[model samples]
Target: MKDTNHPLPVIVEQAELTLAGLQTTMSLAHNTTMQLWQTFGPLKKSIHNKSNGGSYSVQCYADNFMSIPFTPETKFVKWAAVAVFNEDDIPKELEVLKIPKGKWAVFSYKGTISDFGKFAQYVYQEWLPSSGYQLDHRPHYEFMASDYLGPNHPDAQEEVWIPIV
Candidate 1:
């Protein structure tokens, strides 16, 4: 069921990471990604001992997440964060998430954030099912750096990271 236009992902092994930022409960139907980033973006300077990898937008799904269709009400934790060297001095307003080293599939995409639904649909419904790798329980995320042009810009580019076993 692979679509000829679908982009393939790059499989890689990533090291463990400790991220410091803000988290919220949300779903596709109730997406607040823009607002979250809007609030967190300027605060990045307040973070200490951060990594040079830029900003990380992470989604932590429930254990049964992949087993069922992703509905609007399907709740998950969305974190707007940056990698930190350690959790010793986090801002009181932010929390830390420690991601263990794991295998992941990285997809590079360029488009407005609003247009990402189709891309995700293709990945989870087609590419993932057809590929040999299964979704791992770890969190999924997007990495955006100097190239990121913001949410509304169609030229915005980011690397989508999907945890896989």
Candidate 2:
């Protein structure tokens, strides 16, 4: 059944990445998060704060990202992710990915981490289902690139990339 009320975004099929480096694993609910916020506060966002319990199996460095299954409904406390890209024709210091070729659903979001989750909800709840592509049970992640001068920069841009089949 086509959902006339929900509109889907254009889906791009490309195998640009295969793995990603998750520099940090954090949840806003935990008290230990202060340390992380102090260090990487510039790039951070609030994901769904679920009391039902959720855990993310994330790994740093795309090269070491092993394929694993994950539950979609299990909510996670979101955080801003910054991409470590290839510089000077060479991979960046956090070089950790070698994508053999896979599908990706890319979306762009601007501003602070405050509205990050809302953007995600727009994708997962609204975009994915209407687009006709099912979610790939893999380690999905976001890409942090663009003019991010620091946490204070309001124009900071981010690319949210989810692995798709």
Question: Of the candidates shown, which would achieve the greatest TM-score relative to the real structure?
Answer: 1
Per-prediction TM-score: 0.92, 0.50
- lDDT per residue, candidate 1, 1-165, as tens digits? 435565799999999989999899988889887899888877888887887758999999999888887788899999999998898788888889998899999998888878898899988988888899999999999999956788689889899999999
C-alpha lDDT of candidate 1 relative to the true structure: 0.88
RMSD of each: 1.7, 10.7
- In Å, residue 44's CA in model 2 sits off its true spot by 18
Please report, as a residue range, the 10-residue window in candidate 1 with the lowest summed lDDT: 1-10
Error of 2 at 114 (Å): 0.5
Question: What are the per-residue Cα lDDT tens digits for candidate 2 across 1-165?
Answer: 433432333356654432222245443444233454354343222222211122122322232222332243323433322322332232232223444346767666566666665666677767776676776644565444433444345676655566666
Best by lDDT: 1
The lDDT per prediction is: 0.88, 0.44
Roughly what TM-score does model 2 have, to 2 decimal places? 0.50
Runs in model 2 deviating more than 4 A are: 1-10, 14-24, 31-100
